[model samples]
Target chain A: MDTKLAMHTKNLNFFYGDFQALFDVSLDFGANEVTALIGPSGCGKSTLLRCLNRMNDLIPETRSEGEIYFRDQPIHGQEVDPVEVRRQVGMVFQKPNPFPKTIYENIAWGARINGYRGDMDELVETSLKKCALWDEVKEKLKQNALGLSGGQQQRLCIARTIAVEPDVILMDEPTSALDPISTAKIEDLITELRKRYTIIIVTHNMQQAGRVSEKTAFFLNGVIIEAGLTSDIFFNPKEERTEAYISGRFG
Target chain B: MSASYTGQKSYYGDGMAQNIARRRRHGRVWHILFYAATTISILALIVLLLNIFNAVFGFVLIEDEVPPTELAPGGDLESLSQGELISLLEEYLSVGLIRRFNFEEPLAERSVTDLAALVQVRIVNPTVIEAWSLQESLFQSDMIRAEHAAHPGTRVQFRSWLSARFLVSPQNPRPQLAGIRTAFFGSLWMIIIVIVVAFPIGVAAAIYLEEYARSEIWYNRIIEVNIYNLAGIPSIIFGLLGLAVFVRALEPFTSGTVFGGVDPTTANGRTIISAGLTLSLLILPIIIINSREAIKAVPSSLRESSYGLGATKWQTIWHHVLPASFDRILTGTILAISRAIGETAPLVVVGASTFITVDPKTLFSKFTTLPIQIYQWSARPQSQFRNVAAAAIVVLLVLMLSMNAVAIIMRNRISKQRRI
Candidate 1:
């Protein structure tokens, strides 16, 4: 494995108003590798994913105490622009939400707003092709994005995010709202994306975490229980809680 | 298990059939009540429409000072063009009457249609001696003829009060010569200014309140509550506000004196500009509340998605929020404008003229809206004036409905283009 680091959080603490949501959570994500955060509902896995892009700033009275570094640069530094950080780290939400615009515009708007000065048609095509959606949607690029099925819409959202050329893509339960067929397609796409972009995914399905990620971190009660290689964590968990959760004894 | 079985058996035995019947009876009662309410509203609307239509068309006894054949050179007044009509007016009408008509607007500047209208209204001078409701005119022809015979000089003929001449001519002391042209132009001008002034400002205020202002702040809460209350405030109160501010305090600007006065004699701040600004204030709260609701209807997911794509807040609102809610905003605008069009108390307080003969030429000119004209006519002692007012009501209704239709069509087109 390559030794280059992509992102790392050191003792990250997050609070929604006065209620602490994430406590003493630390983990490392390597470049060009898929890292999965797995936990039950309200376990703060999604919260931590949002923290990487500073998306929690949108919620009122949310405060974070800790340090997150991206490519060795302090992402949460006072001088750092959240907009620039978000541009470098794009996101796909749990439910697929494409803009209520045409398919071409769904991909083009992000690039245009980020000051991309290239052949827009070419960029749209490349982004769509990378998500494995070009062949399905190429004939109707000008149609409204809302016309696509759920799985295709999620892929379109991914293409829209990558159109801005982000270094890291954060996906929060991207396949939960989709059917089995769509879930399989997204898993295959995620595995293929691991070679080019650093991927961080928050998921509730332990099997999905084992299937797509090279490294897996198990979260419970707003705290990281264990972190290691995917095979080591699933086959030989060091913690009893991790082992219990993986074996479906309790969430 | 025995105790639970006993409880269930006792519950089921307690008039189960009666309970279902009682529930069905209650639902039937509610259904009857709702149906009765709808019927009452529909019946009221129908009665109102019938009353207006009754006055619009009927039998009338007309008496002309000079018959059409005597006034026109070829005994066919309808065949005359602008030049011929002007010459005929000059030849037949008194020099004093020609001078009066010219003083209102130059004869040379008037179009062919205007000149022809002048011939019918000024030269022939036909007067409506007696009028009958549509029901009486249709059912009692012998009675009408006998009544016409009693008035030997009058001729009996069915007349529609809402006619081409009624739309073109200006108000006259004689009910037969009165028309709504001035009031229509006044309303058209006022509404144009209202849309221009209120639409953008209302939309901007809505965006600021909904998108930027934090609801937790005390002042933002105050603004929100105030807007809700303002929408409920009596329109007459807004009229009083307009009189105090636009008509009196800001007279110089409202009268266009600040911009080098065009008509200093008539520019007394009771002009179209003042009325338009007053109406704008009257509907601003409505526009704001409706637009706020529309903008609020845009899903938070859309905003989050835009933000997640590295787009700024303004960009998110512009690219996604505004377009998605544009049709709803237009619907709100149409409602606000409709309210502004029908408003009379506010315009009356702001000094709309009751008997203006000249059409409004600019924002600085004194004006009278359709509702004000109807109000003035209906207040008169003469029964004939009431008939004219009824005709005016028909015009006003048609105008309002057409405006709403245009706005709805525009909204539909935009929505269709963005259809998923």
Candidate 2:
């Protein structure tokens, strides 16, 4: 099977004011594969994920000192617009942040922003269908996004991210706040999503990382400890720290 | 083991121990004190409100029917109660009483009874009546007959003073004859002009400072310091500044006097536009400060999300921030306007008169605000004008309270809509 790298990073270093957050991070997100970044809290996984789309540029004091290439083009190049970059590299936040708008508007927000002049109904329906939310929410698009259940809202956020027609999707702890049923549903959706788009997800759950991603990178204290196929990383991690963290001996 | 355990016991006392029990009692006492202080403040406010109502209503009932006691001449009104007072008043109305009382003219030609009629009316005694009758056989007119018919032989008191007539009557030079019509219209004109001039400017400045200016320290500091200082400035100072700038410097455009051959001083200095501009300046800072706060209060996450979706700064602010902050900004504006309406010192300093006979018709026309009129009436020599002043105050207070209530309702509606 021939697979291409959808996104690649080279020697990326990030700093928040005077404090360095991510040190010499380099990783590739494979096309049509789920890549899970597993780490304890404050281990730079989310920071590295944000660099893929230049979301860190929103913070005034945040500065990065390396190149991040997406589809072989430098994502952080001066020629690229941050707004355009965000449109092509859609993200779902840790918390389900549906805009305080109607469910229909929430799903349609990205399309409208990108000046989608086509039929909104078809686009919204297709996007919701892909997120597995069309049947559940088809009759209630007019209701406020805030009125939806947590699980529904997270799916709505995911649907919102996908509607922008991005090449890659970044989910930062997408199902961390959901119930067991909702988590299972999102895990299934992630597996299904691998058929279409490149997916990079940061997860705290070691089992979730093994179950969802084809490959897993375990990060600890702003450094990647191990990166390998998910089965190898789970069954026989080479690094002592990776084994200790995954086996619940140390976090 | 017993000795070590006893050492630990000193550090971590049991809940049933005396020290821990005492600490818990102290915490409870503090909580009780906090609640007591809050209740005491509320009780004090209630008592103050009850006292004011008692004093106000006590006088309202007693003075509702009498020809307001406040309007009666203070000491020995015997001369004012007599015959020639009506003719004296009528004559003074033609030439202008302000000039006569203040200028001391000769008795033959000087006709008007003067602005101090509450005291001056007593001069018309039976002796003066007999003298005036012999002197003026030429003044036998139906108007005189009607004036006699108007003065029924009822003794005037505080109770007979308040009538529907007081509300609609035009202001007279006499304290008893004075009404709120001119002052009411003056306040109306002032508010209209103020809103017209201030609202757009204040909102524009706020939008610029909050949305467009992104932390350029110098401009931000200037805006921050200016807003804070502006809010702190005594409003009357704005009145003085308005008198200097609008009344004196920009008088040509506002009063339209200096351009054509219009009499500059009469047309320029004491116009409604000047008063309104003064009030606008007085409230501008508050509007800007409150508006900025309202904008700031809108969650930054909302802005980030909008921008993340490729919305421009103006679009984000207009579509998201503005909708979210609309209620707060409106509430702030209403509060600022209410403050402007009740302000007396600045308007007083800017030369608002007490008793203008006619209502202000245009921006450049002569005007008198309610508070200034009340101030002038209260300073008169007669005690009877005091009642008139009180009644005027009641009207002004009612108007102000109603405006505040409307503002509160608007604020509630905005918040309720958001909540729903």
Candidate 3:
């Protein structure tokens, strides 16, 4: 019923075959703000992020219950198409996965396939510029994207996601595989991206959550332990388990 | 277990040095065993290639019934033009023989080589008195000449059976005039048909199995198992299947009767089309298995990213999965094609004409592939036919190697363009 919210989930439960990966979980993401999901390994942050875009549908026998909404529309409705939901809500993976194509093509392919009829060159340049990769890759836009460094390739992936101009961007550990400098660059890019799009990022680093997120949700055993202001979650949490996880007492 | 000593040796313990020496001796034995295995494989290949080459190039002593010098205007058969050679054929050969030659093809339209072969077979009637391999010809030329001196009017010449004339003339009873022109075209047409019929169907089946089919489905699992097992089935069994289906059941289509091409001379389903389809059946399972493996080798991450970008399964496969696996698919196709080209049993059962001298002008025409030609020649009673079969083997190997080389070049170019 929160019309102003960019997206919200209502009692979402997910399963990989018979084994449950997510409990009945409800969460909301504000428009043009960053929300961080912090959890230990196998705690289901990535699974939940994937569920938002129905990316989990690609895995065989994996199922999700309950509802996910984008703006006012229910994404999990029978009439709703997964492709359309994913087009509106783009995703950035944990590792850079650029298409085996030129840098320009990597940014243009998603938009082109989604029926983007704009000037492709302008779109590629703007996407790269948004990710702050234009200056570095402008001279070699026609070169293979895989030939780039890990950080640059990740930036290219981000640029590729934003090229389609989605309303929300889901990043599952966007900088988890990068070095410190590249991580800093991505954190800054997140700050810049937050001004235009709602970002829901899954991260293992609590400091990153405190640094970039307006709101933080802590996950434990496929369940949402507590969610509140990032400052409060880091400073003072309502749940003892949330505090225990935040203070690094145990996973 | 804890004892140690050191000087020149880094370390030593109770029974450790003896144990190490024994282990090293065992290692040496295994090493020599592996090395011998590799050497045997290499030596076997070298011997096979050497035998083919030795048979392909050699020397022959020939005695012409009528010397070519008397037939040629100036006793130089090589200098005579096509018209003159045809005139010579018309002048000397009987009308029945000329008509038989013309029935295969028009004499006027035939190449000079064909006219010369006719003169040799009908007029000069050259027969191989004796043949010697390159090794014999090089090492014992004097002994060979003296051994064959009893044969009157015999001329000794170095004759590489794989010559230009051998490539152009049609099959003949006389080994001196026999050529691979008919068999070459037959093989070419058969291979083209195989590629056209097999590549697309095989790749599509592979894509379906790799991308769409569910492992949990009963029929899919059965199909998967069948494909793998089909790859190991004896090719002769495929020939029997082809004989039953392509040669008999689909006789009308295979014989070109459905297309209104009815030839009274050899009106049967043992045509190029039937043989091609038969060979296609023999290699289809192999192509499918290889293509599926290629499709499977594409990284899961690339596919995941495509799906995450909202690409439909087909769109993702068309744009990403197929391109990433292009090189491997081509490699598999090349392997399948090489196997098909050298396939003999299926075509033999599909009824390749052993004495087929006419070039296959259409798919419905009588056909014989290179391997079939080799089989036919080697099985003949004549010693010269067996030697020429060696030459045919050389041709087959060259064709296979060249095709593989072209495919490898294409695969390299594509893989360089996309290394995913």
User: Which number leads on lDDT?
Assistant: 1
All candidates' chain B TM-scores are 0.88, 0.69, 0.87
What is the C-alpha lDDT profile of model 2 across A1-251, one tens digit per residue? 25798988888889998999888888877888899999889999999988887878766678998888888999788798878877778888888877777889887877986899989999999999999999999998987778888899889888888888888988899999999899998999998888988899999998899899998999988888898788988999999988889999977
lDDT of 2 by residue, B62-151 (tens): 112223233345532333433344444454345576346446754334333342342343333111011112112224444444444555
Per candidate, native contacts kept equal: 0.69, 0.27, 0.63
In model 2, state the lDDT of residue A165: 86
RMSD of each: 3.5, 10.1, 3.6
Question: What's the interface RMS deviation of candidate 2?
Answer: 2.1
Model 1 chain A worst lDDT window (10 residues): A1-10
Query: Once superposed on the true structure, which residue ranges of model 3 sit more than 4 Å away at CA?
Result: A1-3, B1-30, B68-75, B78-122, B264-266
DockQ of 1: 0.71
Alpha-carbon TM-score of each model against the true structure? 0.92, 0.78, 0.92
Local accuracy of candidate 3 as per-residue lDDT tens digits, B306-364: 87777889999999999999899999999999999998888888899889789999889
**Candidate 1, residues B11-98: lDDT per residue as tens digits?**
3555666889999999999999999999999999999999999999898988877777776676577677778888988998899999
Give the Å shift of residue B217 in candidate 1.
Answer: 1.7
RMSD of 2: 10.1
- Best model per DockQ: 1
DockQ of each: 0.71, 0.39, 0.61
